[model samples]
Target: MLSANEIEQVYWLADSLGEPGQRIDDGLFLARVAMHARELPRNLRRFLADFRASNRSPACLVLGYPVDEVRMGPSPTACNRLREKTIDEIRLEIAAILISSCLGDVFGWRLQHEGSIIHDLAPRPEHEDVGLGTGSRQHINWHTEDSFHPYRADYVGLFCVRNSHRVATTIGALDPDQLSKRHRRLLSAPLFTFRPDPSYLMSKAHPLPGTDRGGILFGDPENLCLRFDQDYIDWPDDIDGIAEAVETLRRVIEASLIHMPLRSGDFLLLNNRRAVHGRPAFTPTYRGTDRWLKRINITRNLERSRRRRQSDFDRVIYV
Candidate 1:
């Protein structure tokens, strides 16, 4: 966490470049900030390295930009179209900063769109009206993003641009010590099965190479990690304790959850393997005032992970 003065300095630097109603050139703004905050890159990297080395609970690195309240339209311009050159420039700057500052080796940064380009984790009225997108729903339930994929990201970044709906909260689960004996046994047992959601199976980018038969969870049993989507998993027909296992795991996650809301200009980076995150359902009136967030995926250096590099380009699907 940075001090109040440091936070204010960051905002002041960003605000100095553009007028209240004018859009700041993201690229120039980032370059200027980077020049002034040269130490920031190294400091952030050290923090990430130490955090990972200690194996402590999940942490949130909130950037100091003040929330922009005036631009609360339901549907803002597409991220790519907002200020094309500036957007790409800022993205590159941010990516460079992360690579220079974080614990992991930087692979690459890819931008995701809201529709077919990225997965809308929550149900939308245009898609389905039930399940996770019931407008009034509060809890997002615990789950990893695209867990069925064997090549999931090592770290995930969410950059907020519009968050007028302060109710959109991101909750993370971190209580490893409270796992019950039953929960431990089930997590260790290979009873859970994962399959691609039917609708997602035929899509151009199938997560894993093969058809279903993916493991629902991975990592050490004592410090469990999960990759499960309730709608996509397929429990074995003969599995006797499936129901109990699911219930026990849910209980543990709910009891240990931590909530954080992202305001404008806040960037949240999380260890995908160690933490599971989800957001409360938000009412999207298509009025341009709905919550909007930009997402980026990063793969830690395989050499650093003590593993061989699979490809020159770290392949990832946005949705």
Candidate 2:
């Protein structure tokens, strides 16, 4: 949470941008935000440092940030049309980017949400169960964000613009200590594959074809990373044990899942590789008063995805 003084500082910095809805390069925007980060209160800086380096937890919540009341209009019902941004939205996105820069560099994908650097999370009636953010009524089963892609985010950041209904976001982490030796061994094997979600295919004319294949868990046993999507993964027909193990894992996660409802001014950061997040079924009023949230993906290193990138200037991954 930022203090009133800190909030004023942020507002001043955002106002210095001169105009609302102006497009800024990622490098320039990050540099400007980083410069002002030094002015942040001591406790806020320490919290950002500790949270970015910590390995024990997969998610954390921040409270008490300030949101503009008059400028922020009703929530939109779609993710496309990225040119529109309100004064409040601009300030919120800048604030979010500052916090995320502590974790890593933020990025986008060409085949996801129209290559939006900052994506919207609003209920779209036409797509309620399409494996996308707009799927509000259908249970958005737990899965690592962009689990189908090799260049998935290292950290996922979300800022709640408005959530009057208190829509809860569910999250769960994998603990190696609880898994049996056999289950761990099976999960570490390269027997699992995840197909790209439907939303990615819809973003392109002729989408790339291929499934992401890898182990479900990786790294040290004490602190492992997970890559699983209940709706996207599939195992070999002959490998019945893997299937059973996955089902058991699913039940275990459900039993230990935590529900976090983000209110106005609430910001959350989740380790994308180590945690799975989802949302339960909810009714959307479709009236401009529906719940709204802004989201972005971050990576610790940009060079790791160079091969998948189209050009040096283009940050959005194509493959």
Model 1 residue 110 CA deviation in Å: 9.8
lDDT of 1 by residue, 1-319 (tens): 5467755554444444334433222334333433544444345546666766664445456575444445322333233334323333243234333332354433321222312111123223443333332222444555665565555566666666556666555556545566566555655566656654433443355242343454444567556665666655666666667677766666766776666767766667767766677766555655556665655455554344223233333222333
lDDT of 2 by residue, 206-227 (tens): 5564798888887777677888
Candidate 2 is scored at a TM of 0.92
The numbered model that scores best in TM-score is 2
Q: Which ten residues in a row have the lowest lDDT in candidate 2?
A: 18-27
Question: Pairs clashing in candidate 1?
Answer: 45-101, 73-288, 73-289, 74-287, 74-288, 74-289, 75-288, 118-319, 119-319
Off by over 4 Å in 1: 3-41, 66-140, 174-176, 197-217, 302-311, 314-319
Point out where model 2 deviates above 4 Å.
24-27, 31-38
Q: List the residue pairs that clash in candidate 2.
A: none
TM-score of 1: 0.67
